[model samples]
Target chain A: MNENRKHDSNAQDRTDRDWDLLYEIRQRVIQSVAKNMDLFGVTPSVGRLYGTMYFHGQPMTLDEMRDELGMSKTSMSTGVRSLQEIHMVYQTWKKGVRKDLYQAEEDWYKTFIELFTTKWRKAIEINSKEVSNAKGLLEHLWQNTHDENLKRIVAEDLEKLQHASEYYDWLSRLVESFETGEIFKFIPKKSEA
Target chain B: MNENRKHDSNAQDRTDRDWDLLYEIRQRVIQSVAKNMDLFGVTPSVGRLYGTMYFHGQPMTLDEMRDELGMSKTSMSTGVRSLQEIHMVYQTWKKGVRKDLYQAEEDWYKTFIELFTTKWRKAIEINSKEVSNAKGLLEHLWQNTHDENLKRIVAEDLEKLQHASEYYDWLSRLVESFETGEIFKFIPKKSEA
Candidate 1:
């Protein structure tokens, strides 16, 4: 290796130039992703941290991530935790590595499906239960009331509840499509061509 | 009509009880809707304003909404304006009515479709354009670079861009599914029964 030092240095210089160009292109993409991550319910800074890790194209330890992004280690951990909670990032066991190494889930479709479907499903579960309970209460009122006025009001409320119940059922199916990847049949994840 | 004064008084008391029960049921629904409105990106207070108006079951003027929700009139206007921009609420002219009247869009499915489809579509447009531009620049670099190492790096980045482009295309179709109501066929707005 030492005998070819002169040739290796030239190769190294060109290699550095190639890497720099790659970085420049990936940087803009990182910026774009970071700016739009409010849709993911994360702060822009946290988004930037994830974007940087993603574009780096390799698993990184917390210290390396903090150094690369110049973020406080605490903030990086917080961001990583949030991403983990959403299943957007996860720690991987690197051979013989003592430090925890993290990798971004590169499939954007899967990321969107996990984060959004979970959120909407949770909301649907809680809201639908409350709605069902309210419906039951209204139905009970309707049965107990001898007065025409109470019955009429309860009947109208019951109709409104019925409409809302239908909406939740539709939303639940929408979440299931994403969770089950049934949506991909309609909207293919890869380009057909 | 005044001849049945005693009977009318009894009917009015029962009517008030009926109205109170209706309000109780609707209030919980409104509260459930409000708690989940963070998904729409508005503050809870703003969501509460919309929920109150929605359950009010009529076109309400700004003053009326403020009075009903005990919010400042300014906040009511702000919330209404935000909801209107997102197509969740709208202004309607009531004939012979001087004040501007606002109505909540009652169809939750349509509301979700409009808000999410627009947001995801806008994001896809911007991100895909930037990605295409970056891909073009990398191709330009690939063409000029004689170095094998540089060529390899450019090729890899191009593959990454290709993958990302595919995801964006899929997301664009997802937005279209919502906009065109293609998703409704998959997840019907009404229950099958």
Candidate 2:
């Protein structure tokens, strides 16, 4: 009986040590990621929320996430909402809880591409439109220009604008293909048929 | 005398038409670019200031840029200061002008590299550090594990961490070389360059 008791105590002691170490390491990682996100103009809460979802590898309720990330309910709600807006996160209604559960969209590339198209690509499209309008004005002036040197410069700039627009159109088409799950096989296979 | 009068009037008329067209085109391009920038959370004044410098192909004084982009003195001053903070705009003292002239860094790749390293890389570095800590935690847990199945699952996660760290390292290296301009030459030179 004494030998069994000794073994049980040793196991408990070992488990306690392991848990302490794990918590410490996790805290360090969380702190480091938070600092980095701040540098990128991302809120620290956003980083923590992404980091937690990424590490969990499963959907977690807001209360669960709040406990796991050591975040307040308000911070988790706001951060998760922003991440969902950026398409880096998704929400699912669990059967029991009134609160929604969230998960990081596992495919990193797709998440970034979605963000690019929705946010970054819009900017590019605007720039392309501006360039086209600029080309039109330059063309109008070109018709009146007799100077060979000025005409050559204007012509080259117009060509550059055309190329930029063409490239953007091509990229937009390519990205549109990834909107559905077909193109990216990188996503882990869905278990439920 | 009649020939001279006709020629001079025609030249004046053409010049006036060209200036008017240039002004109109310039405004359209500037406005569109500004709108895109606003979508990305950048101010219109800041976007216009950068857009003007980008298309101008050379630096201009606050006065010159104000005249060229048709911005007020107050608008140009505020915009230039904001761009300067982000290192997207650089100021140089002009020989004739009383104040500093601002220029856009012309090399798109180099400017992107600078922005990535200074702003984005910091975030990556923090992520890398967190990944490292996660690695340490996994190692500790792996050593402590008696359940082979649970251990295998955790080991797999650690392996993913290893791969993720490598990716971040590779990205940082790529961005680092970009600042030197050598990376662009190594790749097939884009026509824009």
Candidate 3:
């Protein structure tokens, strides 16, 4: 249990209250991260495990995670898989280690680019397809109709659909820029962040 | 039912099948919108109502919306209020109009800026505050501790918190730029979306 004894040159002596203070400090961030995980469509418990792993700053196995979080091993496994799927955590092969290990992705910007670009691209594809279909129907309706009133109404709707298609096209480009990291050229992630 | 007859110069003579065709066309967009509305954290039905109103391209009363969606009036009212809260729809007044009219906010870019900036800012504020508090506690512990191992651990944690704080600051600036439309200058929302 005493990792300090194994590696440290000096004998360690941290009081219970000192450990409590350290726990309290990280608790704030862990809670905050858990709350914000909702933004990424994850439950708070899964987010909490990620936050705990982030603070650990070490590769962890499912058993280690379960021991630390007091969650069931099954739950820990599911949580880690979910986090990995969202680009928040990754499974790693540790040298000389038999059990598979997992690590948290510390770079938030990289995670955002990877995750959001995929989601945005999917949404853009779905919406653009719908717009195209609607445009085809409206255009056909507009051309075939002998009635001027029907033509006018269909034409108006067609124009709106055209605008929506254009928007979807632009959004597709934006999604590409994100995936390519070209957006950083415009937003400039050069500073401390 | 025959507003076109009252307004148009000629009498209308369109079959029921023409109306069915038009409905089919709008159905695609309405379904697409309903699916995407999950991004804004609304139910599909509410999003469907917004999409229907968007295609209508005019201010409509609650009763009119209920009739169009075939939803109960109470459900319509709730959906309208939820849409208004998210800046997806707005209450508009017509000259001497008795019943209040609600219109969809068709500009998606404006809606994105308004909604996301507020949510991002709140997240930035919360995470930054937590980082500040953690930094304060760690710094104090590091200074007081004679144990080099404890100090080293706290120092490492402190460094992480500092980077996190900087990220939050940069994110805050990004949120403000979005709110002020300053980001558009760099990304250039010029072409379409």
Candidate 4:
């Protein structure tokens, strides 16, 4: 009886060690991703959610995530919804459970491209307008300035603006290719399904 | 006298029109940048501050920015500090102002290089630990699996992580070039001083 009890305690100790390691990794991942996302203007909660999904190693049901992250059901529900809208997270149904399982999208680069072209595209569009306005300002300076050097500089700026449009166009095409999954062929993942 | 009154009113109306246009541009630039920043995982204020500085045509004094953006003094102070910390914004003294003026670094792409590398370096460090943990999991699967295909898949995953590190290295080099100012030389600006 004493031998059996000793063996049981040893087994429990091993389990506790495994849990501790898992917990530590989860915390570190969360902290690093949260800081980066904060810089990127993504919410800490969103980073936590995605990091949790990535480190967890498989799809996790909402209940599992809630328990793991120690978050309330309402917060998880809203966070998962927001992640889905951005195409960073996806949901799938489980056979036994009624609750939905969520996972981070595997392709990091493509996820970034989707975000860039959709949300950041607006900024680029606004920039294009600003560039046009700057051109007008340059033209004004060109006509008004008696300084020959300043006039030449303004003309150079005007030409640069015309050529810079090509870079933006190229960026748009790169984003399109990522969105269409052309980049995935190069990635060599373990499995698709 | 009646003609003089009409002329004054018309002048006032045109001034109002110009103010409205500037206001509209300010608001759109803020809103667009705010949305992009959120998508990227940084704060809305960071986006607003950077966008405003970028479009302001030249570096601006903190007080000048406060007036232009119509933000509270405290908000501008915090936003400018945050931008400076990220290396996206810089602090410089003007000839007249006692207080420091803020400027978006001249080579914007270099700033982006720092941002991307700092972020990717963090991800790689964390993922390296994850790869170690994953190795244990793979070893466990190798011990347990009778199925050759599943074992083969795990081996492929292991191999992919090795190759993926090469991609990360390549990406690092690509982003590092942004700091070298080669791209900036390709596009001419109106004037430096």
Candidate 5:
């Protein structure tokens, strides 16, 4: 009976140690993701919370995440909201539970599309507007200018703006393709290549 | 003779107006670029300097650029140095002139490859290191833990890390293909499509 008890205690001790190691590993992953997200100008907490959920491989409660990550409740709420906004995380309802549970979107391809389109499309929109603004001003100048050399330069500038506009349009189409999963058609498969 | 003199004066006035209009357009383009650069976490001055050089479509000396863009010599110098470091601008030596002249790279494809690879590769390098670090810690945990459930969880985490590492490697290869212009092969030609 004493031997059985000793074996049971040893098994319990091993389980405890395993839990400690798992927690340590999760923390390390969270820190790494937080650092990378900061480089991309994203708030670190968003990455940390997402990383924690991803490593846990299960839906986690906000309070669980807050305590595990040592983050304030407000920060946890804000981070989870932003992650959900970006489609990187989603809330899941548990039966008989009032608090919402969240999990990271584990598919990297979906995450890539979300992030790429969000950033590049915004950049394209801003740049396209600016290009049009500059083009308008230059076209007005081109119409009124009488100096031959200045007319030539203005023409060149207008052409550059046109080129930029065309590229932005093409990029917008590409982004649309990504959103629709049509981009996979263009990406040559190794078998076909 | 009096009529000839009047005609010359009128032409000079037109030239002055053209110069004024050109300066205005240049300023607008510079402002647009600076705004976009700020969005990408780059300094406004760097974008301003590059935009000025690109729109000018010719090599410009530091003093000339400073006068045209209304930038301080210090800002121009620093901005130009940074642009050159990124391979977006190149210095040219003018005959019978001591001041260094610089021009923006005219080829968008070359510029795109240089900029995209530089930024993305640096990001990949940093993220890859962090992923590896996380993987290392998890591997150590997996080796030490005797709990079957904990070992299974650790194995899954390790697989995720391996997948991330592989993706980063594939991205680095993609960057290299971009550098080598091999990416063009994958891009569907409109004519063929």
Candidate 6:
């Protein structure tokens, strides 16, 4: 009976070690994803929550996530909500469960398209408006100025603004295409056998 | 003669007003560009220098840029050098001028391609390496573990890392296509008569 007990303890020790290793791996991946998300203007907590849900591969409740991630309930709720708004996470229903369960989308391509299109489209729209304003100001200055050097300078700058405006307009459309998956249509796919 | 002098003075005042308006416009554009560059992890000074040179539409000496932009000689030199390294700015020689003159590339398409390819490729490369490391650790755990729960969890997480690594690899290739202008070939052009 003592030998059996010793064998059971050894198995439990091994299980603990395995859990430790898995936890270490999960932490590293979460950190990496969080760092990358920082580049895209996302908070580290949001990335961490998403990464956790992704690897968990099962719908998790807010309390479960909060406990597992050692985050406050408020933080977990906010992060999960933000992820849901971005379509990175979604709600899942479990039979006989009243609380909502959330799971990571796991579709990286769709997630990227949604994230970048929203970001780039907004950026392009802002820039386009600024370019237009600058162009208007320059044109007004050009018309009112009489000096040859100043006229030439204003003309050149106005041209640059117009060029930039056009490019941003084009970029906005490109981002729209990205959203619609039309941009991918341009990419060549391998021929099927 | 007194009346003529008054007229000349009035003309000078108008020129000054025009210059003031142009300067204000330039400042606005520079600020906008600097803010956008911040998103890409570039310093504000670099974006300002690029905007100034782009609007100037002429090769400018470092001293000239420093004096006009109210920046220190050291900052001007460093900003210009960084811009040159990225191929956004290039040195040009003027006849009878001994000092090197720098000018903005002014080709927005080329500039975007060069800047984004360099930044995104580095990001993808780093993420790919991290994903591979995570995958290795997970595979190691999977092999060493006998518990079915741990095995299933590691297998699922391993699949995620593999998927992410593949996506990053594909994105790196897409950036290469952008560098080669092969991606542009896929873009539909305006019909020519």
Candidate that scores best on TM-score: 1
True contacts kept of each: 0.64, 0.42, 0.42, 0.05, 0.44, 0.55
How many Å off is the CA of B31 in candidate 3?
A: 0.8
Tell me how many clashing residue pairs each candidate has: 0, 0, 0, 8, 0, 0
**Residue range with the least summed lDDT across 10 consecutive positions in model 2 chain A:** A184-193
The candidate that achieves the highest DockQ relative to the unseen native structure: 1
- Model 5 chain B — which ten-residue stretch has the worst lDDT? B184-193
The model with the greater TM-score, 2 or 6, is: 6
Candidate 6 lDDT by residue in tens digits, A146-182: 8989998888888888778766755666677778887
Q: Compared with the true structure, what per-residue lDDT tens digits does model 1 show for residues A43-92?
A: 88888888887776689899998998887999889889999999889899
Instruction: Give lDDT tens digits, candidate 3, residues B1-193.
Output: 4777665533233434566688888987899978986766778999999988888889999999999999899999999999999898999999999998999998887877777776777778887888898888888988877767667778889888877876676667667778888866756655632
RMSD of each: 4.0, 7.0, 5.5, 7.4, 4.1, 3.5
lDDT: which candidate is best? 1
Model 3 Cα displacement at A10 (Å)?
18
Error of 2 at B97 (Å): 4.5
The CAPRI class of candidate 6 is acceptable
Q: Candidate 5: where is the Cα deviation over 4 Å?
A: A1-17, A38-40, A186-193, B1-15, B38-40, B63-72, B129-144, B188-193
lDDT (C-alpha) at residue A127 in model 2? 75
Question: How big is the positional error of residue B93 in model 2, measured in Å on the Cα after superposition?
Answer: 5.1
Instruction: At residue B21, give the lDDT of candidate 3.
Output: 84
The DockQ figures for the candidates are 0.56, 0.25, 0.47, 0.13, 0.40, 0.47
Tens digit of per-residue lDDT, candidate 4, span A57-162: 5788888878877999888888888888888889877688777888877665556667756765665676566656655666665676555654565576566555
Segments of candidate 6 deviating more than 4 angstroms: A43-46, A61-67, A70-86, A90-102, A188-193, B43-46, B61-66, B71-87, B90-102, B188-193
B86-175: candidate 4 lDDT, tens digit per residue: 787887777877877788664543554576667666766665566566556656655655556555655655554454444445444444
**How well is each residue in B30-92 modelled by candidate 5, as lDDT tens digits?**
687666664344687788888888888889998988997788988888888988887889999
lDDT of 5 at B160: 83
